[model samples]
Target chain A: MVFTETGTEIALHAGTSCSSGTCGAGIAQNPVQSLTPEDQRMLAAFRPETVEAAVKKTIETYKLFSYTDKILVACSGGKDSTVILHMLKKFGYAIEAITVNAHIGCYTDENLRNLREMCAKIDVKLHEISFRKEFGKSLCYIQSILKAKGYDYKNCHTCGVLRRYLLNKYSKPLHPDVIVTGHNLDDEAQAVMMNLFRGNLQVCARIGPKTGMVHDSKTDHNSATKKKFVQRVKPLYFVRESDVVKYSKLHNFPVYYGECPCSSDTYRREMKDMFKSFGEQRDEVKEHIIKSFISISEPLKAHFMQAEGGAIQECLICGEPSSKDICNTCALLAKLRDNKIIKS
Target chain B: MVFTETGTEIALHAGTSCSSGTCGAGIAQNPVQSLTPEDQRMLAAFRPETVEAAVKKTIETYKLFSYTDKILVACSGGKDSTVILHMLKKFGYAIEAITVNAHIGCYTDENLRNLREMCAKIDVKLHEISFRKEFGKSLCYIQSILKAKGYDYKNCHTCGVLRRYLLNKYSKPLHPDVIVTGHNLDDEAQAVMMNLFRGNLQVCARIGPKTGMVHDSKTDHNSATKKKFVQRVKPLYFVRESDVVKYSKLHNFPVYYGECPCSSDTYRREMKDMFKSFGEQRDEVKEHIIKSFISISEPLKAHFMQAEGGAIQECLICGEPSSKDICNTCALLAKLRDNKIIKS
Candidate 1:
């Protein structure tokens, strides 16, 4: 299963049987093709010499590297991450899988079970992290506690922040240069929209293939510092959500076929609905938005980095690049602890 | 306990009291002195010669009246609504109170309980509804279900939307010429900031003292139009949140003193924090925002009335203005019912 930008179609070309070793028809190949106008545009816009060329380009841009840099794909075992992992492996990059089983009391264990099976098939090392083990808390318990405390954000926010925290802290010993995430085009576009909506140009600058404040030289401190914030990359930054879904389907990829358990009460859904109302105008308007963002973001990005006194302080609890005396992850854990939630 | 906008120093002199006297120092028998500097200025500016004069000079110019006919107050049995009601009553206008209790969730019960006690004290009549009574679901239940459905907005958004829906629909049968709400300067200004942050000019137009939407000749349907989105008025439009808080405390008025159960999420809270860091600059900024809003809104309000097709067909289930066959509220409730929600 493969995806391309500027086009809506996913080409699922099955590998020939090891014994046959030829690309002619009936060597046991199932070639599924999706050809749509959306696909056509995506392909043309994000054109590459080959899938390998695209892969190498993404790796260099996202810095998914290793001196033994050991790239850990923070896979939900979802289509985007799976595709990312598969491509990285194809390019012969050192890689492993990290799955955070943030349960919503539904489909989580099942997804993890499926992910384990996929790891076995791929013969790659897969690491699993569970909220239950770390906090002795299930999704329900944490949700109830947060609700009780009048914590503001929706459930998905909690799941996301906690997942990023756990993935980073747990993977620290391995010292991976990159944590390859599965953020796709729609996700990137939404962040940009959200940031703009709130007049948060800093957030717009802070998110992307090379996200975060690099206080070591990278900019703004009053706003979201890229250095303090983790740098994130989207290998599928140009891939549409639809293509990923289709590719996963056609390839029989063991992906988590569900929405993020906590995303139901957010404005992004509102934006999606508004975006959908545009019909054929949707992609064009969205692309227009993205292109506008590219230009709008550059000066601010450089401006933020050059601002003085912007430094990443070491976290007191954990030696991560932090803006405060302690990092957000450690602060959150401390909050959890203060609430007696460490063993919830 | 009283409030006068004359900018006097609230002299508690042992002098003659006016008609219907409730005096603190003494029932003053002497004639009152002439107006102070601020009072003279206001008298010169407002020139409240008659009801029409008052309406035209102060109210109309500032948009205090949406309709010259009926009065409908969104009451919480709090000082804000109570004061609006009291003033409307003094002005010899028809008026009533609409209160939608969000089932209190134990905490809110205390608020409503206090409100009811105060209403009893003031002899202010209240028409009461609750999330449980009307929708057969607690906010908690609705929230959990919506969360499950992959919806994600700030919790306040859901609460605000539901309250608006209920208030508007219930006000439909009363057939008031205008719906009067206790939205003071703070609420209006905060909302304006929120809209601008989100790049939503349309929604911002829907707020303020005399919500200019009713006069938009283009889509200006009558208050009794099937959509039931009547005009909203705020007598306390110029009152600051701090002033309101101070007035309520000074008068020993019955008021809900806590924050909304779900407001500390999203960009508004962030804005609030940003303003807090700026101290009184918030008030200056708010005044500036509201001034700008009025300038833009006056013409937009006229255009809004003239605009057509803003309200689509009424929801079949609820008979409310809806874009689809059903409204988002009714649709959400239906989902809840399908999930066996008790109230829905």
Candidate 2:
């Protein structure tokens, strides 16, 4: 039996053990002695079966992937992504792992080490990409340069644009049928709210369990670029974040338990706290939010799809799929080069 | 100068004194000694002109009401409603006030007293309705009866349905062009979130500055009943709740500052708190929520309107406008009577 962060003592599976001590070392070191009433209530309600059933149901309902498909799992070295990667491999799928090292101080360094060890143990071929190698600068350095140039975007915003660009660009050579992300229900719900709060319904239209599934065949301008851009699916779309944490602990995954150092975005932190507050009052608040979003998502997609005729455009500089003449990554790169922050 | 709840010291409008003494007695009784950093920042940013400009813009932009229109303001004796009523009268609109006394212990009693005095002071005709005279029981008594019958519903839900029904039914005889409400930006933003969280997009479709403006003339079944149901408009749709409080204090309106005794619903309280948290981070967060909601509200309304053909129906029992054959109020009343909790 091992005590989790919520002070719940969980028994490991009968035959399962962390043969590699690195995987379960973090949990063993930090055995919480006390928990708040809310934590106790949440931990007491944790059911492994419920979480597994949700993942299974999401995959089958959404028809996310097939046995014949070669899946590429994006490992963020966090609990959510690590759990998804392990689950997909255990399910006997043809799978490989890919990660982007943005070099956010010691946070990324520890995560990368943990991810490398975890992948090698599972016998999965792990591919690594780095911000320094690809963009000639670490994410922090790029952010600092941009800040000096008076282009002050949040760290997550800059990193997100770059990471997505790299993931798509690099995955093409691997030729995977689909890219799998570990975005749980909590993440998706937060995204729905953030987009709504930012008046970005068109962006909201592009998210779901099967990302980028909604396409306007007639109006879309870049069918060629669309073919180049692989679809992404989320198997954990219906699972909760706490469930992911519980699953990660139960399986003894070697995952960094800390948040990204640069992810202190006030808006997202506020949203995360808001969800926690709402969840305490209604246990299924996250599920309700996702369900409501899904109900309206189709109409939202259809409306915007038809409204923005010739919606997708190939980036003039990088030849990548974009909503405008230039993709976000290329635009940022152009800004950096124009300010002589980075050599062209 | 008077110190407000947020610890903001404000000078009252020049020559505008609380000569009656009862109007500003609440503020005079106790002054806040200290303020949190958030409260200090919010108070520092208070501009009465900005609030007035928003209200004026909402009225003009939405074409909510005209000078010739007979406006019946729904006065709840709360700061929001009181401010809206005073603003409309000051704007030179022909206005009167109507209030419902739910008899929620001392809360509604005090509110009713304040409503009467404020209406008399403003030289507006005051119309009062009571649950005992209209429904044969007070709201609290009815709630207890329903709870005893094992039909437990939140007080706000029950009260909202009955109050809306009474407002429409009673306002018809007043021959007003429109029934004005005090739903401000914060309230509307909360409703948007609540409806989204509850997966009640159909209900969300019916809300806006000009409530119930989205109608399908071809598909609507109850044109006659609709005519009987006076439309409700919100002139303070763009104003913030805090601004409403400031406006009320500025004018020294006699208003009850406490919340309704029956309004301890956890879901709404959570939403309100979430907005407050978001507002602390971004001052225009509420505005963004409302703007995003408005952008998609038209499509939301249009989609649901067409989907729900014959959208409006006259309640079979009461002949009031409803979305179903039997209205919520009648359906609830039927349950109470059928359980023998309340005499028919």
lDDT of 1 by residue, A1-344 (tens): 22234323232322222221222222012223433466455544443334336556656765645446667788876668877777677667787888887654335654575668777877778989988788766655676676667765466666776887788667767666667788877777777655544444444544546553333334233443232344455677656666565555545566655555346677677557645654575665555555444533444444444431443344555544444577666776667778776632
Candidate 1 per-residue lDDT, tens place, B13-127, comes to 2123322232122211221232346534444433223322432344566655534577777876555675566556656666667788764343455457656765676565667
Model 2: per-residue Cα lDDT over B54-106, one tens digit each? 88888889888899999999988889888888888878999999988765655
Q: Give the winner by TM-score.
A: 2
Q: Which ten residues in a row are the worst by lDDT in model 2 chain A? A: A11-20
Q: What's the lDDT for residue B21 in model 2?
A: 34
Give the residue spans of candidate 1 off by over 4 A.
A1-55, A61-68, A212-215, A218-231, A305-332, B1-344
Task: Evaluate fnat for each of the predicted models and list the values in order.
Answer: 0.00, 0.62
> What are the candidates' interface root-mean-square deviations?
11.6, 1.8
Candidate 2: tens digits of C-alpha lDDT, residues A1-344: 23345534232311224222333323222324334466456667677677777877888898899999999999878898888888888878899999998866556666787789789989999999988688766776677667766888889988987787788878999999889999998888888787677666666665669975334565455455457578789999988787898777656577767566577764677778877776564437667777866777767766675565534334765544345778677888678668664464
Q: TM per model?
A: 0.42, 0.79
For candidate 1, give the DockQ. 0.02
In model 2 chain B, where is the ten-residue run with the lowest total lDDT?
A: B11-20
Please report how far candidate 2 places residue B233 from its true position, in Å: 2.0
Model 1 error, position A198 (Å): 1.6
